[model samples]
Target: MEFVERYNGSGLLIEVEKILYEFKGVQHIQIFQTKSFGKMLVLDGKIQLTEKDESFYHEMLVHPAMLMHENPEKVLVIGGGDGGAVREVLKHDPKEVVMVEIDENVVKACKEYIGIDRGALEDPRVKVLFEDGLEFVKSCKDKFDVIIVDGTDPNPISQALISSEFYRDCAKICDYFVTQSQSPFAQPDYFKSIYKNARFKNKAVYLGFVPTYPHGLWSYLIASDRREIVLDLNVIKERFENRKIETVYYTPEVHISAFALPRWIVNLIS
Candidate 1:
């Protein structure tokens, strides 16, 4: 049987297939779906977290920056309401992690249903701020060691967040900035526009790959003011090999390989 389960506040209606299983530990598991995406498993059967390959999305977003930065402290995550990004950031042992999510309902639903975050909300270093990310960055005086923008696609409402002005503010407040720059294969124009705007202010610009997103391949942009991202292949591989931390997705080889792209993609951006 099928039934409609409305996300309490977000107004996102998800159609549930069946009650899969319950995790007595933290969050329960249930399978569900929406029109845009296909079948998905909901933790506690409430939050819709992943459809097929969530690991690709989570890992690609988190690891590149964490491994790239020699030492990162004070991270600002904008729009990752699910807390997956926070969980990954904590692995680097940052002093503080602040997540600014526009919708509190997303956070509530994920915590209650999706167990993918692995209790990142409970971490002592994490501070979840339910507010607009654009506004939060405007008043932020302190610069961050790393800034990750894990936001949704640019719709009418999110246009401002992708605007040149917002990127300007990001440049002023962040030492190093990384954001989902859109799929180069699907959204080449959007990618070019964002890349051009970022280059105006940033000294270094780089792109990485993410599978399981739209177009079967996605892109992320990294920029810094003082430092150019020097991806030392040998150093990254060695570090991944020696990492004491447990990682399901990111390895040293994968970390270095993600940066490698096709010649056509390279030529387009170059």
Candidate 2:
């Protein structure tokens, strides 16, 4: 059986599948059927982004801040080339949504193939910039109400995005900073380093879990200059209950439940 797709100019490959329907949407984007990870979206057709259970990743990234802030207007998203993060951020109806995605191909593929992003690119309020996120943060003079760092794993290329310096830069440009820290179960050292770095730069540091990612669980770190790290569970629940938008995964109950970490896991961080 062929394991690779015919190469397309935009970095996409088409693959013939037996058990799973595999297709390369772009140079870095591969979609496949999987038993555990669900329909997986692989970058460079290599790293997995989502499975069938995508709501877990999307909800954990977006709702915590949406509920935490009284009202968020200017929102900045870094490295969310797939647009899943942007889709969730838009629920708040922010005045401006700026996405700094280093790879324009990822955004193009996601818009053309990924159903989850659901036309987030077409929103008039969104401004897409094809540039390095780290540089964008460094040069940004205006601060944002919320900044979500939806970056990939810490390979050499992504190392700067997860470094202490990056978090410091983010602190300067954002009121609230939320990022997908490496999964504690898979890359505890990486997560610890980022957590410690974030704690050193920002006042509030908190963690949340998403279940769809590798190890059937994932972690995210939240840092803010002024606000406490805890999500207002009551407020989030109320917002979900009153929400007019159709949602697949996030609810008031799920919002509160995701934050409930096991004592062992909490102790590991402490």
Candidate 3:
């Protein structure tokens, strides 16, 4: 059967070529393909990633804050079972990468089907933990230089991850952090709330395009306890050159532009 997903009353319909895998775990996980997007991961009828443009989302989510950090040796990732984010983090050659995901099935399924991970989960620097992300962050005592929250939308099941308490817990563990905030074009109110709740020493919102997602636009909220973790185009360019990192969609120029929000959205959040 041809698969179709309606974007939660957004009046957008996404059609799939076939259902590669569909099963119940914490949520309904579906893997499928489309002519435009290659392979895709869908959870609870929401599009997560497409192989064609996954790098844009993953790199935008992981890199800017990571480059800002003087030395992000140890990292924590919450809810990125697909390992795309970890794959990007590994490029920085961090000493350790710990990923806490509630669903082992998603990890296994992605490992088997999604080529985006490129065997990142098996890399020596990564440690995958099957546990609730909220509890994991609260209980973890060891600190990290960077923490990435690659969580889904703030539904009933995952709402706690977007709460002020959860941000507090994250702040306790990392000097710098980033999260996959929803599209400011699609869910500006929700995005504003998440940004306001994250009362860090330094905070900024950056965006990238995710063609398969609701609006083809994704925003990430980056926060740092360190005041010097500001975005400077020249510094970011230098960092990229020093690391010799190659990316498909992210560049220092793009990084600088992503923060230039529309005046109304800025006022709304302000």
**Tens digit of per-residue lDDT, candidate 1, span 1-270:** 454333223223444555543433223434444444444544333332464456666666776776677777889999887777888788778899999887666677667655557898889889889888888888889888888988766654345677777788888877778887776776688777777777534433344434334445677777777566767878776555554446666677766666777887787778
Write one digit per residue (lDDT tens) for candidate 3, span 1-270: 344555546644556777789889788899997766788898887778888888989999998988887678999999998999999998888999999998898998998888678989999888999998889888998999999999887876678888888998898889898999897778877788799888887788877888766678788999877645576888888888888888999998988888888787678687
The CA lDDT at 244 in model 3 is 82
In model 2, which range of ten residues has the least summed lDDT?
Answer: 5-14
Q: Give the runs in model 1 whose Cα sits over 4 Å from its true position.
A: 1-52, 200-211, 238-243
lDDT of each: 0.67, 0.70, 0.85
Off by over 4 Å in 3: none
Top candidate on lDDT is: 3
Q: What are the candidates' C-alpha RMSDs?
A: 7.1, 5.9, 1.5
**Alpha-carbon error at 126 in model 2, in Å?**
0.4
Clashes of 1: 2
Tens-digit per-residue lDDT, 1-270, candidate 2? 233322222222323343323344324455555445445566643444554557667777777776677678999999888888898998888899999988787777666556577888679999999888889888889889999988877765577887878888888777788888876766678777777778533443334445444455677777787666666668776665555545676676666666677776677678
Q: Rank the candidates by lDDT, best first.
A: 3, 2, 1
Residue pairs clashing in model 2 are: 5-14, 11-26, 11-27, 12-26, 12-27, 28-44, 38-52
| Candidate 1 lDDT score relative to the true structure | 0.67
What TM-score would each prediction reach against the true structure? 0.78, 0.82, 0.95
Q: CA lDDT of 15 in candidate 1?
A: 44
